[model samples]
Target: MEYQYPFSYDWTTQEIIDVIKFFEAVETVYEKGMNRDEFMTFYRRFKEIVPSKAEEKKYCNEFADSSGYSPYHVVKKMKESNPGDFVKMES
Candidate 1:
């Protein structure tokens, strides 16, 4: 909960905020539950900011190292879920 999020210096302030929001939504998926639509909204914006697969993996791996939550898992679950479903990770 007290870890720094992975971010790029090249990004604008709003882009950084959007990236953090997406990471927080990933956290929410593990901590409680998030609506699929809402989580995807965050993910979509995140993709806009981090378009490269390598870059996304780097950021997500850093986040997992710091926060102990896996963005990969959340996205995997998201892929398996329907629009109205709630995406949650079991502890």
Candidate 2:
């Protein structure tokens, strides 16, 4: 990846790490595939850090702009899939 992960100055060190992990999971979905449960774990933690939909959109947009990976689409696929399904995307 040529770009840095989007992050907020207000986040703590651990929060930043968790947010990065969430982005990484998104990356995994596009590059290969990720387990629904594993991706959900990251997504849940991401929600904890960014509870507001507006704020979440801001972060996701920034990440997508830099990385060309859409977190929104990944989350959408995850929500649409059943348990034990893999989340995958093609860009």
Candidate 3:
């Protein structure tokens, strides 16, 4: 939890905040549960900020390494679930 979220200096302040928010949602998925649509909104914004697959993977890997929470798994679960469902992951 003390780990810093991965971010690029090239991003604006708001972009950094949005990226942090997305990572927080990923944490929420592991810590408790998050609404599918809500988490998706954060993820959509994250994707907008990090459009490159390689870059996204890098950040995701960094976050996973630090927090032991896998954003990739959370996103995959959300994608595989039905609309209006709550997404939860094993911590």
Candidate 4:
């Protein structure tokens, strides 16, 4: 069985990077275009959100552009939170 959130198991550096990239993408979308300032802000916040360097990757493989975004896994995560923010709100 997999460990659930608020109780994440463990994380690795690669996982952290993957998530960071994900956020960067999201920021791009959120901004409605490429905004370096907004991206840096999101990136900084994302870094703060991750508990540690040995961090677990949430949204590990959900990016449509990336091959790693596993559909099953991404769907599961989508089912959890982010009720409307992802769609209702652009980016």
RMSD of each: 0.6, 0.7, 0.6, 12.1
In the range 1-91, model 3's lDDT, one tens digit per residue, is 5899999999999999999999999999988999999999999999999999999999999999999999999999999998899978977
Q: What TM-score would candidate 4 get against the native?
A: 0.31
Q: Clashes in model 4: which pairs?
A: 11-55, 11-56, 29-91, 61-69
Q: Would you list the C-alpha lDDT of every candidate in the order shown?
A: 0.95, 0.94, 0.95, 0.41
Q: Give the Å shift of residue 21 in candidate 1.
A: 0.1
For each candidate, what TM-score against the reference?
0.97, 0.96, 0.98, 0.31
TM value for model 2 = 0.96
Candidate 2 ranges beyond 4 A from true positions? none
- Please give, for residues 7-88, the per-residue lDDT of candidate 4 as tens digits: 2235466555645564545534434543334334444555565645444243433333353223233333334534233421
* C-alpha-based local distance difference test score of model 3: 0.95
Regions more than 4 Å wrong, model 1: none
Off by more than 4 A, model 3: none
Model 3 is weakest, by summed lDDT over 10 consecutive residues, at 82-91
